[model samples]
Target: MSSINAQRLTVLAGPSGVGKGSVKALIQQHYPWVWLSVSATTRSPRPGETDGVDYHFVSHERFEEMIAAGEFLEWASFSGNLYGTPRGPVERQLEAGLPALLEIDLQGARQVRVSMPEAQLVFLAPPSWEELVRRLTGRGTEDAATIERRLSAAREELTAEPEFDHTIVNVSVEQAATELVELLGSPVKAAH
Candidate 1:
């Protein structure tokens, strides 16, 4: 691939419960060449979530400080929490001629589009609305009120599908991961 293509940034985004994380995990395991950007968020860590691995969990004050210092490539308030992509790590990855992948929500994706026009946005959609609902509820991580809020947001996010450059229907995690890797134009280094 050309240097430009090697450094191309890809944003994976979609409604909640679309299995973006699962697809991302597969890519990380199978394609170690693709650099995935870990986001910083003010939200408290969920069960089994590590500090630097899953997210760089920070306090609200620190998140605000980052925003004021222009440290983020893109930041947004979602589900009453602040989440952002740190600009430094992504810049370093691109400088090293690596394809960078960002798995973020719809709001963060929009911000990335404006900040980095060259980014390729991929929408991960569920097989069906019913399946989406089931996935959201089945997680059993959040309470009923939170699930309802996510469902409402998912409805809006689904409408924004046309905004994305490509749509990957996540019928299977392995299939979706393969499709995303193909989109990035990155060769798989190993398969696990």
Candidate 2:
């Protein structure tokens, strides 16, 4: 395939606590070649999140400016916070013949589908709904009401699994990372 045709802009989407971050981290550690696109968000950073690493952490006005400039490949407002994938970095990586990964939410995934139908959408699923609830509650970052809201969103996300081109159940981090790397059309190296 031509470099343009083999851009491999893969979208990894899942519910709030389905280990998408964990799997992506593992892949980055083992296969540094895969470029994971950082999203721009209007939300304030959580306890350990750093700007540019976890997200771009832009102001709402700045995000709006970017939107007006057509800078985002996909963007959506969720629970009052706006999140989006910047188009530049992903385009650069693809132009360099590198596989680009976007770890985004369901709404962003749908937007990407609309904009780039050739992009691969992968749904990372929890082993079970009970396990999903357990993981979300175990996070301890949110209040009871917030956890309930996340669970509700998760239920809706789970129902949209059929919308994805592929589904990987996150039973083990190593296994899921391997599956994700394979889906990106890259050979998995030795796991650290």
RMSD over all Cα atoms, model 1: 2.7
What is the number of backbone collisions in each predicted candidate, taken in the order shown? 0, 0
**Where in model 2 is the C-alpha error above 4 Å?**
1-6, 46-48, 187-192
**What are the per-residue Cα lDDT tens digits for candidate 1 across 133-187?**
9999999899999999999999999999999989999999999998888887754
For residues 98-157, write the lDDT of model 2, one tens digit per residue. Answer: 789998889899999988888999999999999999999999889999999999999999
Alpha-carbon runs more than 4 Å astray in model 1: 1-4, 187-192
Model 2 is weakest, by summed lDDT over 10 consecutive residues, at 183-192
lDDT (0 to 1) per candidate: 0.91, 0.89
- The C-alpha TM-scores of every prediction are 0.89, 0.89
